[model samples]
Target chain A: MTQGRMGASGAPVVSFENVRKVYGHVKAVDGLTMDLRPGETVAFLGPNGAGKSTSLDMLLDLRKPTSGTIRMFGSDPYHAIKAGRVGAMLQSGGLMPEVTVRELVALVTGFHPRPLPVEQTLKRAGIASFAGQRVDKLSGGQTQRVRFALAIVGECDLIVLDEPTAAMDVETRQAFWVNMKAEVAEGRTLLFATHYLEEADQAADRIIVINKGRLLADGTPSQIKARAGAKRISFRLDRIDEPFLLGLPALVNVEIRHDLVQIQSTDSDRTLYALLDAGYRPREIEVSGVGLEQAFIAITAEDDRDGNGTTPGRSDSAGVASYAQH
Target chain B: MNSTLALARAEVRRLGRNKRYSFFSVGLPVVLYLVIAPSARHYHVYGVAYPAYYMIAMASIGAFSGALTGNAQRISQERKDGWIRQLRLTALPANAYVIAKIIASMVITVPSTVLVLLLGRFYGGVHLELWKWFAIGGTIWIGALAFTALAVAIGYRFMPDTVQPIAMFVYFVMSILGGLWFALSGFLAKIGDVLPTYQVTRIGTDLISNQSVPATAYITILAWFAGFVVLAVIAVRATAETV
Candidate 1:
């Protein structure tokens, strides 16, 4: 299964150079630029309508970019895909119906220049038990697994998936990542687009965040968290000095409702100390670390505010909550 | 090319499993021929024996129904289900899906055409030279191929729900007016003169009667085929981004 999985050069496995896809008046992907290295598990993080699907579509050569270019394996995406170097399972990707799972696997596997044994792929996708079942008759999760099986049916060096676990339950989602990890361990580069923040945080070595059809942030989990603000501090003060509180050290954002002030800071201890050193006693002080979910919210919400100038400070939580639903 | 052929092979196998396809393309025709051809022995159509003419009619009915309905509905449903998109992700070439579908349609037309002619031979007692049989079958087979192109156009250009009625409408109009169900005369004959289905039957009956087929018959079939191919190309290209 991992025959050609060795000793790739330093060249990036995939790269998008200012790629854009315009649909009439809407810019689906606007000047998006990024690159993926070999053996890297990168998460494409975005909200609904954040151009994640469009970008992945362009990368897979399913949809052409209106401007600029995308390259895979240092070649055009279409040629690289035709060479059977990249395997993909998109949310829109569907199975051939009216056939047994095993037959569908075998048929697709035969399309590859270097194909794997069909039984091994069926087993790896955890679909061996239902291999005899018709594809259209399976449950949603089983159908998803079959789609995943098709992606790994060949000796691919890169795998791209869009919301692969969207239909899976928690237990199935965990099992899926375990199976996915085994595939990536063969030194294959994996790029998956997902809105599930924890999945992105847990599975990806690097996370590339996009918002409104552009790159918002690209870094490791910790760096993204830090860049958004590592700590959140909320306190109540008897004498509310909003301006003075906003001026606190290491403050990233400040939200005030009467005497209750919520603060997001890079260093919570420093901000709190500065508040006390300013001769103000704040009551009910609470300081906590920010999870990747909150950090993602902060990053995207900030972008939304900057981009549209309509969703104000309160949108940080509201916008993210709505985005998480999709 | 190999991948496309593999896809076409799988398509053929799936079509074999479909009871609806089998009934429309072979079973229905064989049953219809058994029931209708015996009683029509005294009648004649377009200078050919009634049994032989009905053979062409039944064969044309089966081939047209199978080629148009089975393929159009499947293509539209597959597009809606994202099967076409999934195939696009494979290492197969871009046009492989459409080509494979056309190939499968052509392959499937064979059994139906041959079955109807065989019924005409042993059961209907319509005798003809072996080459005439081949010519008739081959002509009907090519007509089915032409309809397959129109099916592709309909499938690519519309969703499954819309394709259902459109394919049915086309099937009824072509089969009835083109004299697949009955021989045309007077005004209906004038109207049926231009249809590819009527022309296909004309070609078959002309071959059976040992008459020179009209140039207009060939021109009508070719024009429809060329027009349908262009329509299929345009539909496929229009949906390129979405597919």
Candidate 2:
């Protein structure tokens, strides 16, 4: 929220200053303070019901915060929407299922005073050939892409996507990131909500993870993972040696009954060197670094009541409420 | 006015996309006037006015289509699509939306009125009187405004998907069983006298068959339209929910 002049009115592309969205007795988002600059892509990583969409919705002004303030493009998102500056591909996407893709894009663009030409929009959405096809006839992944096209057609400054590629596959998802990188290169800001760690690792300049409705980690993709960092160091011995590795410095506190070692040390480099020096030139060695997915799991799992992905709903409410107190 | 016209054009296009209401807006009144109004003197006690009847029927199509098709459904659709939320945040002002809706109804109503006249001239053996033309056209337009308001007001309460079937049923049931379909007379006839279609229809019959429309009937139809207008204005404000 610390401001400059990206917006027409001198606001950041998006700023959430202690924003809290309360629904009845529950706080969907609590004290979420985030900022996005123009042309930056930030991925919101969280498990289901972790308030990722709720935060996105509030920023999009589809849902209003019960308290605090969110400024998109230096004004309220609702204001930005009217100004035709805030663009979104909501979780619902709001596609008229009966209309052809061309018509859907045309109708949405019609709301803007100076939308991109229909042909260009169709091509950008990657559905130029499917423009005449009915939306109901398209696959879910294809429909998701159409939503993406519509959001960008206004040539808006900020784009908010809530689970944009939820229905996409491995190949399509890879291709989508390529297409998205190209789109982002055109200087549009993106606040993407995604569950895929690899997607975040590949597509995001920065990553923010939310657990129990509060910001658990926020930094560059590599930084956040490094902060919650652990590594899986595995080697295939001639057989299993449990006590031998446990007694060594690199493999200290090793659960080495099997041919596996999980080092919780901050320095994987030092540990791996120790392993090699201890006459442990193994047949095979695998040292996998900490990843965003594991970091999310580790953070949420710390507060988890059960092993399930479900965070005690009340805990998020309490956690978010606690945010306001601070 | 240009803004209103722009919105109106879009609404008209959107309304035409619905098959059920496309018939109500563009097809039903023309088909019925063509097939039925020629021999209205047969069912009625003589001295019937064909053009007045056709005009009332035409005007009511504007009223019906305005309430049931675009205005009513648009309210729900906007709310569901977050269009209302979007507009409220804009400088467009919610009143502009209401004005646009009423104006759009006129866009459809005016054409439907012309089509009805053409159908009456070709198939019903009807002719419009100079004075009767202004009287019936004015009455029909007033009726459309009222119905359009009520339709939008009610339409705002439901989602678009659920609105169509219920609205279509109301229009069809009223048109047929409420005596707009036939000239049934009695207690039901008394109730029909108050219905916009019934009163507008009877007023049109008087204007065409006898070269005179009842002043009382015109006032009653206009009053009903006024009530709808008031409700519509209220509905727009309530749903606007602006601070």
Candidate 3:
């Protein structure tokens, strides 16, 4: 009823349908299809040259996709942007170096039809103290904060940031998330692109992973790990028979080096109980959720095998589970 | 409309703060005018006194160079720094952006024109009726529009590192060919007659001396203006499409 395809509450805030951007013979973004609902925080997670930036560029109308369409709030990207409904923080663009931070923010705020107060925006971005300083004089983290202030001053409903925290140090990155939490609390829709798995895991409600211009996985952080069946359980054992370990319930893969045995499983508790009931004394057992980094590697590796059928190591059941999770 | 005005004002403020821009575009012209105009004060060429002839010529050089080089350098730098990309993302229309840049370039041309004219009157001992002074100044300013378009085209076409040198070289070549420094004759005169700078300076000199400028000069200048404007549009469109 609400235009194209509607999500849970209503029409999706953003949608891409079979979008393909080809530069020469190389496809920068190939057959991308996704939807982002309003009031949700989503992260596009990809490694370098994985088409994340190209997708963001198309969404912002800065670059036209070679084929297919993209819609923002049920409208074309250009119209949505022109209506001042979308704001963005680009990854590595220069600000006017000569202007003070306050003046630069004020200039950008003036472009929006409904801008927030300059002082309030500055304070919220945690750059109030440096407002009078010229932009060229700021440290890398402070400059990133200023760029953040520029993004939020427009009173936009949807904020898109392409690698917003790439320039920040660890402490600055932490503080940035704190400020971002406050902004997202207003029920605003947020989409960010990042290669940092941890940032995506901690900050995003949903993660959409892409590799080689294709969508590899799409789900909540926990759901992605769960779907990949990549929970890791490691322990030290004096001796363990490899064949017996492979037969453990819910164990997808096993790696044993020296006295350490690491098991990847769908259900770590079941595998641990299996080890105990089997009379294997595994000491110093550590059960940790497979970090998104590992899951990403697994997903991409599976994708590579599926594409070429040359490299073969993953079991059929493990590969089927990953496919079925999508 | 408000957005355009704000952008133009910001550009003007930026130019005001840039000491290098002021020196190269405004200060250097005045110094050149003062140093050169006085030496030729007592001379006459083609029935026009030297002071009046050199005054209008030098003012033309200053105004044309200031508007063209100032706008071109800023555009190339902004393109290099990614400010142009930032602006493209905003709701501000492309035409508005172009207009704001032109307005800013015009604003920069004022001081250089005024300073050169003042030096002509005080230092070179050139005397003209009040209306003629206004007329000559107005002609020089209007003629700068052609160069403004050229600036935009050059800015969008070239990289920041090479833009300044290119702009300087073009200005120098055009100025010499246009006879701003001295009178041209024979083959040189024929080339000078066809150039836009030559026509622009003629418009200014003709106004100050109360001589009617041939209609062809006006037509030629307008034709060059149209051509440069078309080039600027093409350059900007090509940049937008490719990037």
Docking class of 1: high
Docking quality (DockQ) of candidate 2: 0.24
Prediction 2 global C-alpha lDDT: 0.66
Report how far residue A108 has shifted in candidate 2, in Å: 3.8
lDDT of 1 by residue, A1-326 (tens): 22222243589999888889999999888887778888888899989999999999899888999999898888999999999999999999877888999999999999999999999999999999999999889999999999999999999999999999999999999999999999998899999998798998888888888887887777777777887789999889877887888788999999888889889999998999999998988899999888999998988887876776664333343343234323
Candidate 1 chain B: minimum summed lDDT over ten consecutive residues — where? B133-142
If both were scored by lDDT, which would come out higher, candidate 2 or candidate 3? 3
Candidate order by DockQ, decreasing, is 1, 3, 2
Q: What is the TM-score of chain A in candidate 1?
A: 0.89
Rate residue A9 of model 3 by lDDT. Answer: 79
- In Å, residue B221's CA in model 3 sits off its true spot by 1.4
Candidate 2 per-residue C-alpha lDDT over A1-326 given as tens digits, one digit per residue, 9 for 90 to 100: 11221232333688888788777787778777767877778888888887887787677665678778888766777778767776677655455545678876776676664578989888767888889998768998888888788777776777777878888888777777777777777777778888788888878877777764667666676665655555656666765556655555433235454655555444567777766787777756777876778766765675464425554454553443333223
Candidate 2 structure quality by residue, lDDT tens digits, B76-136:
7766765454334333433655676677677667777766766666666567767776666
Give me the runs in candidate 2 sitting further than 4 Å from their true place. A1-11, A96-100, A103-107, A134-137, A235-260, A270-285, A305-326, B1-7, B14-19, B45-55, B58-103, B176-178, B209-243
lDDT of 3 by residue, B75-123 (tens): 8887787777776667766666678889988887888888888888888
Please provide TM-scores computed only on chain A for all of the candidate models, following their numbering.
0.89, 0.81, 0.89
Best by TM-score: 1
* Candidate 1: residue pairs that collide: none
Interface Cα RMSD, each model:
0.7, 4.4, 1.4
